[model samples]
Structure formats: structure tokens, C-alpha cells
Target: MTDIHIQPRPVVHQLRAFTPDLPDRTVGELRRLLGLDEVIKLSFNESPYGPSPRVVAALQQAARYVNFYYDPEGRELRDKLAAHYGVGSDYIFLANGADEAITLIAQAYLAPGDEAVIPALTFGTCAFATRLVGAQPVFVPVRQDLAIDLAAMAQAVTPRTKLVYLCNPNNPTGIMIDGSELRRFVAGLPQHIIVLIDEAYAEFVTDPAYLSGMALMPNHANIVTVRTFSKIYGMAALRLGYGIARPELVAMINRVRNPFNVNFLAHVAALAALADTDFHRLVAARNAEQRQRLTEAFTERGWQVCPSQTNFLFADTGQDSAAFCLALARRGIIIRPGHGWQLPSFVRITVGSPEQNDKLLAALRELNGQ
Candidate 1:
């Protein structure tokens, strides 16, 4: 037989498999092992309050239409989002999730030798997407305060730089850049560079100084704002996210977007979720109260807690995070260890419902012998 060998692109060699920061044991397994009544999961920054009742009703009603193909354009959801963001419907690009939107952006705009400026410790997906398209990901380290160093990121841009990625209220640290600083940074960048801002946690932010990247799209043709329904809307399982940009840029990205990437149920859920604004408002209010309570609790315990405007809190427990998380897991509490982000002293805890928070605090207090 003649030898026939095929090889993947060299960029494939640089890729590493992603391992989620979760406990080895399932919630059920942990409950049995620990003889516990409940296993409180505080990872992934998911909404403690599940989706709105309207979303549930919408999905139940939508279940009947599963036999039919979903709208390829996702026009209904896009129209809802456009009206909410005060943009034309043509400027919206819906994807399976914000993660897919990012990858699609890379596919559309990046080529071999292209460079993407990314924050060193934000979300890993941005870097992964950049590498998927054979582009170099230039990592700019966060500032000492753990904020995205916009100036340093701007300095990293060069003639080959085609994209810049930012994550507000950065994961693992929860630090955000101020609105003025972000505006200044974007304004200073070259007009040709595509600026992609991942605002997955935008809806949870209560800080007045924080600004949505979508607000900047009118003036900056190169700016792309990617948002998700997974966070505040409690649609994580539904997998619906969208990007806002100039109509031209959206059209370009749409070229790479798979047809019917978003399913019918997700569209229905998202539209219903949008109309049920009161539910989100209540969730946000609860999150705000719990977020502050958790912050104070961590601070009172001498743990260094970051001021987070998101649904999760990042804290340095002054111990190995893996060990810390494991200790908590033994008591039927699950959280994300920061070892994956190279910060072994920290952990990310998702703010949960009041009862869940009470249990977590009690467990922590017991662990500390308080």
C-alpha cells in the first residue's frame, strides 16, 4: 500500500485542551460521599436564580416546534436585542454563544501572521480563538491592581495587530476598567485594528463608571461588543449570545457564522427573557445584596476580596487555592480554584441565593473554627 499522510496546520500544535475548573466528583457523588443534605456549587458564575418563568413557559410552548428548522438569521431575537440596545437590526450577529461569536470574528478577520492583543489573565477563549486562526496572541499583563492595563495593551499593537480583546470585570480577578479610561484607550487605538470587548457580565454591573462597549459602536466602526444571555438572564444552558458591530463588520462576520447556529428554543427563551425585565431586575438586586454580603464576609475573615461588579467574587484566601477549594468541596461546597489562571492563592465564588449563601458562610465559618 502506498503511504499517504495528512497533517494538521502547525497552529494545532500550540493548542492545549481546556479543562474546566470543577471538582472531580459529581454533585450526587459528593453528597453520598460526604453524607450531606445539599451540594452547593459556586463555580462558573452562573445565575443562582434560574431563568424567568416566562422563559420556562416560552420553552415549553416552543418544544412543539422542534420539528421545524429554526430561523437562520435569528431575526426575532436580533430585533429584540437591537431595540434594547438602540441599534439597527442589521448590526446584530447571533451565534451559538459568545464563545462562538469570538471564534467567528477570528475566522473572519485574522490570517496567518496577524496578531491579537489580549489580556494575559482574562478569559481563555479569546486567546484560543486567536490561535485557532493561526494568529499570534499578544498577552498584556494586568496592572498590579489586577485591572486590564489598557495603555499597555494599546502599546502592544503593531502593524500586524488585527484584533484587541478586552474583558470587563475580568474573570479570576473581577477588576474593571473605568468608562473614561476605556473610551480613551479605544480612541487611541489605530482605526484599522478590530477591538473585541467581551461583556458577558455587563448586566450585573451596578458601578456608574462602567460603560458598555455597545455604547461605543456608533463612533468606532472597528469596535465589536459581544454579550451573552448565559449570565444574568440565566440562559447558560440555552447557549444564546450575540455581537453588536457596524453593519458592514456584522455582514463580514456573518459570512463565517454557521447557518442556524442558534436553535429555535434559545431564540424563544431569549425573546421571552428580554420581555421579562422585572425578573432580571429582581435577580440583579439580589445579586447586589449577596455580592456585598460575601465581600464583607471575606473581608472580615482577613481574606483579600476584589471589588467585583459582576455576579462572582474573587478572593485571595492566603493558601493554595487548590487546597482551599478541595477543603470546601469536602464539605459539599464547590468553587473554582485559581490555579488554572496561575494564581494559586485565589478562588472564584459565584454568588448564590440567600439560603445557599448562608450555608456556604456557615461551612466556611466552621472550617475556620470561628
Candidate 2:
């Protein structure tokens, strides 16, 4: 038999595999290895409180309709979202997740020799997607305080630049860019460049100065905003995310989107979740409370905690983050080590339920011999 061989793209050889915080196999393995009945997970920036009862009920109701494909265009949910934001339905495009939406934007707008501007320490997806599409990702370093340096990013732009990606209440570092600053940044960019902002954690924000990227859409034709139901709605498993842009941009993105990108159950569940504003408020309020508690606890230990408007907290532990995370995992708690993000002494902790938070704090205390 001849050995099978096929030529793959050069970029595929250079790509780094995505490292999820908690793989499913790791969950079971951890339980067995640690002799624990259960393990607490606070690694993925997921909501400690699961999806609203309404989402569950909606999924249950839609279970019988699995035989039929959902609306290929995701019109119902798209229209609902548009109405919610007082935009035309044509302004929205639904994808498997906001991550997919980011990739889709890259696919539709980028090509070889094009360049994308991304923050050095923000969500890895932005850089990953940029590279996946064979475009150069120009990484601009964040400010000393770990906030995005919009001015520096602006200065980095050149004739080759085609896209700019931003993650608000940015992942790992958990610092949000002020709205006014973002407005100026987008406004000053040449009309040829498209600015894609990932606001996956926008719902978790409590800061008054923070602004949604959608607010810039009316004035800036180059603005595209991606949001996900995975965070505050607690629907990570559903993989429902949507993007908002002008009708023309959405149409271009739709060309690369799979017709049935979002499943029926996810569509109905998102619709149900949207209507449950009370549950939304409840989760946001509780997250703020727990976030404050965790901040104080980390500060008490003399660790430097980045001020966060998101559900996760990023802190410099003054120790090896990977080793610290491993120590916590052995004690049946899971968190994200920052080594992958190039912060060897930092870790990103999702604000979990009170009991889960207690477990994490106690594990840290033990590890430090406090």
C-alpha cells in the first residue's frame, strides 16, 4: 500500500493548537486521579449559575423538532435581536459562536498579504483567526497597566492593515477600554479597515465608562460587533452567538457562514433567554458581588489584581501561574493558567458560585501555607 500524502497549506504547519482550559477527558481524569467526588471548574469564564430555567424549558420543548433543520438564515432569532436593539433584521448574522463569527469576518475580509491589528495580551482567538486566514497579525503591546493601547494600535496601522480586532473587558487581563477612547480610535481609522470588536463578556460589565461597540456602528461603517450567549446567558453548550453590522457587511459575512450554523435548540433557547431579563439581572448582580469578594481576597494576599469589569479576574500571583493552577487542580479546583497568554506569573479565575469561590480561596490559602 502506498503511503497516503496530501499537500497542506504552509500556515497549517505553523499553527498552534488551541488549548482549552478544561477538556472533557481532563474532567473525568481529575476526579479519578484526585480521589474526589466532583471537581469545581472556574477556568472557562463560564457563568457559575447555569442558563435560565426558560432556556432549559425552551430546549425541552424544541427537542421534538430535531428531525427538522432550523431556519437556515436564523431569521427568527436574528429579527428578535434586531428588534431588541432597534436595528433592521438585516444588520445581524448568527454563527456557531462568536469565535466562529470572528473567523467568518476574517474569511470574508482578509486574504494573503493583508494584516490584522490585535492586542498582544487579549483573547487568543483574534490572533488565531487572523493567522488561520493567511493574514499577518500585527501584535501591539498593551499599556503598562494591561489596558489596550488604542493610540499605539492606531500608530501601528499601515497601508497593509485591513482589520483591527478588540476584546472588551479583554480576556485573561480583564481590562475594558473606555467607550470614548474606542470611539476616537474607530473614528480615526481609514474607512478601508474593518474594526471587529468581540464583546463576549459585555453583559458582565459594571463600569459606567464602558460602551458597547454597537454604539459606534451608526457613525462608522467599518465597525462590526460580535457577541455571545455563552457568558451571562450561561449557554456555552448551545454555541449561539451573533454579530451586528451594517446590512452590507452582514451580507458579506453570511457568504462564509454555513446555512445552518446555529442549531434549532440553540435558536429557541436564545429566544427564551432573551425574554428572561430578570434572570439576566440576577446573574449580573451575583457576579458583581462574587467578583468584588475575589478581588478583595486576592488583594489581601498582596497579589496584584487587574481591575475587571468581566466575570473573570486576572491576577499576578507572584508565583508560577502554571504551577499554581496545577496545585489548585490537585485540590479539585480548575482555573486558567496565564502561560499560554505569555503571563507566567498571572492566572485568570472565573468568578464562580459562592461555594466554588470558597473552595478556590481555601485551596490557594493551603498552597501558600496561610
Q: Which digits, one per residue and each the tens of the lDDT, describe model 1 over residues 71-90?
A: 89988888989999898999
Where is model 2 poorest over a 10-residue stretch in terms of lDDT? 18-27
Cα distance off (Å), candidate 1, residue 120: 0.7
- TM-score per prediction, in order, is 0.96, 0.97
- Alpha-carbon lDDT, every model: 0.89, 0.90
Clashing pairs in 2: none
Residues 1-370 of candidate 2 have per-residue lDDT tens digits of 9987997899998797754444223567768877888898788888889999998988898999999987899888988999999999999999998889999999999998999999898887777888898999999999999999999999999999999989997987889999899988998999989999999999989999998989988888999999999999999988988999999999999999999889999999999999999999999999999999999999999999999999999999998888778878878898887777788999888899998898888888898794
Which regions of candidate 2 are displaced past 4 Å?
19-26
The TM-score measured for candidate 2 stands at: 0.97
- Model 1 residue runs over 4 Å out of place are 1-5, 21-37
**Residue 235, model 2: Cα distance from true site in angstroms:** 0.3
